[model samples]
Target: MGERKLLSPEIVQVTVDKVNIIQAKLKAVQDRQKSYGDVRRKDLKFEELSRVHDVFHISMLRKYISDPSHVLETPEIELRDDLSYEEQPVQILGREEKRLRNKIIALVKVLRRNQIVEEATWEREDQMRSQYPYLFQN
Candidate 1:
């Protein structure tokens, strides 16, 4: 094991002086960085106009109170092992016949579960009937 030297008063003073020097340099660096930020910052003043209502007191502004109705409740969707969930048709919105090159194809606007009216997709009526037999029971 190496021999440890006993700390003298002079050696302790020297170490404290070195630490103070380092702290002074660090403080100077921090002040210089703060001065750079101060240089970029400016006071904003709005001019008073006859008809313009630009600035108002903090008391004049009303705090936004969010309504419970504004929050949309999303229905829970079950996922399979592949992270893909099957979409179930809620109801048939409308039916349309598309004239193809040779035959007339029947299309249905299927309102899927958890989907909005605008998000409803047009699927083949025959395909929807085969898949969801409960839909055509009525």
Candidate 2:
């Protein structure tokens, strides 16, 4: 057994009116928010102007102060006539052997003069010994 309760015509009309009023209010709020958001929204469409690089308007750039500590101190190196200076080995840091397909190549981590420890490079042990014989004296 089920109770069949029916709504009156006046009550149905009142419910429809309330729903329309709520929908109207919701639409008004949505339109207001959309208008506010559209103010800050940008319609970005990119078109390539050049093949070399993308060009940007200079006005978009901001002036920035260069860091004083970023300037590196230039090392005093005696350059020869051909714009090349002889790199003197300061110290031998470490030694390792790299195994290839057929043979193993001996490498020495050498720290050069007037350079930081981080700038040390790995050089072939045989070539380094031949070039700077004094480094291998010890």
Candidate 3:
């Protein structure tokens, strides 16, 4: 077979740029996670807060009792806009990171085809069953 061609400098630079962009995004996502408490959300540098809608401060014991003697619930509008971007599951962040990393690897592979992971031997469906008779049942 002929020798594999190397990745162009332009392709590598573009891939690097994409990787940097994703890294910045990941940092922003992480920062948002810490915004759950009041201070960070309030401290946001947004120019306008109109988008933060339907904010509420829920009381824990509101549902348990319903008597005049009980203190009245004081539900309040907490945030002016939705800051949902600040919150994402750690699993999701991990997945996103993996996705970006995979993209870089794919781009790199365009210039050079190399295996990143070796397949498990057990996945060979065409292999003779007699080779591992213990794996089969009567």
Q: Choose the strongest candidate by TM-score.
A: 1
Compared to the true structure, candidate 2 yields what TM-score? 0.45
Worst 10 residues of 1 by lDDT: 47-56
Judged by lDDT, which candidate is best?
A: 2
Residue pairs clashing in model 2 are none
**TM-score-based ranking:** 1, 2, 3
Going through the candidates in the order shown, the clash numbers are 0, 0, 5
lDDT tens digits by residue: candidate 1, 20-112: 999999999999999999999999999877796679789998988988789887778898999999888989999999999999999999998
lDDT of each: 0.93, 0.94, 0.43
Ranking by lDDT: 2, 1, 3
Structural RMSD, model 1: 14.8
lDDT for 51 (candidate 2): 67
Better of 2 and 3 by lDDT: 2
lDDT of 2 by residue, 72-91 (tens): 88878898999999888989
Per-residue lDDT tens digits for candidate 3, residues 1-138, read: 999999999999999999999999999988777776545455547576667676667763356656688787664433436632221111100111124534521111111112122321212222323333333333
- For candidate 2, the 10 contiguous residues with the lowest summed lDDT are 46-55
